[model samples]
Target: MTMRQHAVSDDFLRPDSINAFTDALRGAKYNVDAVLERLGEAGQEGLTRNQTMPALDRLGDATDAQADLIRLFPLQQIVPRSRLAAFLDVPALIEAGVLGAIGREGIHADIDVRPYGFTDAAGEWSGWVAADPIPGMDSIVTRTRPNYVLGVSPASTSLAQLTVPDRVGSALDLGAGCGVQSLHLARHADTVTLTDINPRALDMARLTLALNGLDLDVRAGSFYEPVAHDSFDLIVTNPPYVMSPPTDAADRLVYREGGFAGDGLVRHVVREGASHLA
Candidate 1:
């Protein structure tokens, strides 16, 4: 297994380029419902298993805008520059750090771009999330990265659904990896603060927010230190709960395994949550 760190430039956050990228995504029907509908049960299951062949088979050889986007994003399959250029601003994608170009025709994504959405009492939340592709995904080819930021996970969806969507004055996403929780919170909170220990996660979260046309206060600190001096009307977190036993740094993953042991991290959050909650 080969391990690699995720890298992308801040230029990806340029408003005009991001707008064009998102517009193309919407025009291609790259949303939760459409992508899943196209993938079917087998393909969906394959994705869950970190297997791409089934989904690739389902997608077939179609180079249509949506299929190409699907292939490029979630599937982690590289697309030929010419194919993507059919619908996307290819040069802008390269310049925006969405894809790499060595003056070559192959376009590859170092990170993952996923379409996420949920409807709440406030309104509809539909947008893309940009995060480091979780390590060990496509398990055969990838290994863990020390500070990998997770995109949307099963827990992410459940948490989003579980959180009460009532409007609030301010909210904090305590461990906002890729800002998934913030996407939901931003709609209801007049202000949202995202804090994470890993700087990479903070970057990914910021990228996620920028892509979604939402901006929030992002700070770097483990747990609550960044917001220790402040409180909010609502505080939300989907923390690392893998409960892994002690291991070397090689075995630790920031998104799942915190420096704390077992559920200590979770316990600390629960124990200290009230003090920060308004």
Candidate 2:
């Protein structure tokens, strides 16, 4: 499988460019409710299974800025430049590293952008999560993307929702991917720190928070290495938890594979977590 090269965090953080890009999304109502309403029930259901054609078919011949983005983002289709420019800053998108020029054909997304929203007792939180597309996504032809940093997923969102929303002085989101958990933590914690083994994931996390007009501390390293000297009032993690059949270390994936034997990663985190919590 030929893996597609993705635009990193630095590529998308231009001040003016990002400002324009987000403004356009807001003007177009490109949030979860709007996109879901546009896709309809059937299309939304198909999307969960990684099917894009249903959504694409439902959005046939639409000519609005939100429609353009819905096609370009979730459907992963190359869109007419003119139509996209109506609702998005095409040049800004290119500068921000989300849109790639396809010569004279059109523009394509270099990363996945999807609407994400959740409601807690405090009310509702919503925003888009941008990251490397999963390899087997219907719109993505590749079979595997080893360095892929995931966007909001079922497992990740489940963990976020299950987390206790107790107010705290500080919180740590270990193995933070695309900053989803950190975003949730920001609503309750006075300060939030996100750490990840993959630097690219850290980059995406920063962009995700920045796009949503939130700020936090981001560090790079495995587990507690970056925050060894520090402590937090709360700690949350949705760690890599896949178990491989063979004992071979090479069989593990960085995102899912914990370097240790069965459940070792979680155990290690648990053992070390006490020292870092107040």
* Model 2 agreement with the true structure over 1-278: per-residue lDDT tens digits: 22324355354565665677778888888999999899999889988888988888899898888888888887778998878876676776675667889987599887777778889878998887878765665855665555568788778988987888998999999999888998889999999999999877887887788788777899999999999999999899988887543366555556777777678878999999999988
As for model 1, its CA RMSD to the true structure in angstroms is 3.8
What TM-score, to 2 decimals, does candidate 2 have? 0.91
For model 2, the run of ten residues with the poorest summed lDDT? 1-10
Model 1 per-residue lDDT at 13: 71
lDDT of 1 by residue, 24-57 (tens): 8899999989999999899999988888889999
Q: List the residue pairs that clash in candidate 1.
A: none
